[model samples]
Target: MSSSAHSDVAPIVVSDVVKRFDKVTALDHVSLSVLRGETFGLIGPNGSGKTTLIRMLLGLGRPTSGNISVLGRKMPSRQVASRIGYMTQSSALYNELSIRENLAFFGTLYGLRGRRLKERIAATLSLVELAARADSPIQTLSGGMRQRVSLGCALIHEPELIFLDEPTVGIDPELRLAFWEYFAQLNQRGVTLVVSTHHLDEAARCNRLGLLRFGRLLAADSPDALRARSGQQDFEQAFLYFAQQAETAEAGEPTPAAEKEA
Candidate 1:
């Protein structure tokens, strides 16, 4: 491997990234990095700009200011686009097509063809436990099943990096576990994942996490590190603690917890 590849270069880097929507700022000078081969969770409540940031990272939208680099190249660059896979919150599959056909369509879009595409289709279907439903029309599947199909489509190209926006939404506990297991397996094989979610329990499974709120990043660190620094018992409490600290700093006041500690 080249020195750059072996070094501690992060797979995704956002430096002071900002996005605006006319009167409203969707992302406010946010910054974070997703390390190689690790699962990095973006945890926050709804309308926290998690999806907006993901869209910018994927080159779907341009940041009004700041820079973003994915896989060592500047983002929105076609050179590195093929090296990434994105699974959005909404199902993007063709509802009239069979599950297998959806995978084939996406695989082809990623430049896979002929024998390789056929093999990848079979592998991804089995990975998501949808081999039995390969021939079933997408509209026939339940919401969770359709989500799995969407995920399978993202995996069909075997990209080095994966971005999942609320991937486990509407999924049962059992299937959620299965999804995490598959994610772990992919990480072991050198794929990096950036998963955005509101589920604290799921956030705890990540190697590192970025807590976001109101278009800003409150904290970014390992779950245990965050809990320890905030003196909280869980991820949710730690997140709230950090958010409060941010608010206090912005308002030029010492946080209540900081005052108590002093």
Candidate 2:
């Protein structure tokens, strides 16, 4: 199949994307892709350059080198960006705005208005199961509720691709599960997703995951394939094993665990 055929099914394409921060090269030639309707995950510990890569993809940070295309269009462009929704690690909401108002504002930015806008708001609130609290001021909502609202705001325009960066951090476990369940439901209906998370169990739900370390793409594979290759029983072990390998390769030394066992 021609290379273009792949992008038709995969809404996200990262081709040798590199990002640097003055003295630190945050992302070292990172490359990956997320297929349409699939839950693609970026997993790694804190400071693994996961957030940096995410910012680059979302147009919050320009890539120092390389390219990222979303929805078959090059990123940081108005044409391609309209069809994408984004939720950052931090709450990106106006505290004084009501939940419904927040969605409407973001929806308007995506060119949604009138009856169409109203329908989208209700749909998002319902999907996040926050319909009853739609009128609540954003500042009054609990952390988890605020996250749901944040998520709802992202969905107001019905974007083809969604970027969620550490969206579940500080969220209660029960609500976290619910939020993921909502993501799975969206995927079932053909919405593409790229989620960055620290929860290994949650990361396993993704069709494929990219493990990052020090602004580098360490391993990118199906959860099962990664586990099998690393002789691990869970995704966490698979990730740690690969991270250690990457570090060893860079440092030209044995993995600490390997040295200890020896």
- Estimated TM-score for each candidate: 0.93, 0.91
Tell me the tens digit of each residue's lDDT in model 1 across 14-43: 988889999898888788888889999999
Give the per-residue lDDT of model 2 (tens digit) for 1-262: 1245333556777887778778888887777877779888889889988888877777776888898876665767666677789898888899999999999999999999899999999899889888999888998988889999989888889877799999899999899889889899889878888899988888778888888877778778888878888999887788889878877776885532211000
| Candidate 1: segments with Cα more than 4 A from true spot | 1-8, 253-262
| Per-residue lDDT of 260 in model 1 | 13
Top-TM-score structure, candidate number: 1
Question: What are the lDDT figures for the candidates, one per model?
Answer: 0.87, 0.82
Mark the 10 consecutive residues where model 1 has the least summed lDDT.
253-262
- Candidate 2: RMSD over Cα atoms? 5.0
Backbone atom clashes (below 3 Å) for every candidate: 0, 1
TM-score of 2: 0.91
lDDT of 2: 0.82
Best by lDDT: 1
Worst 10 residues of 2 by lDDT: 253-262
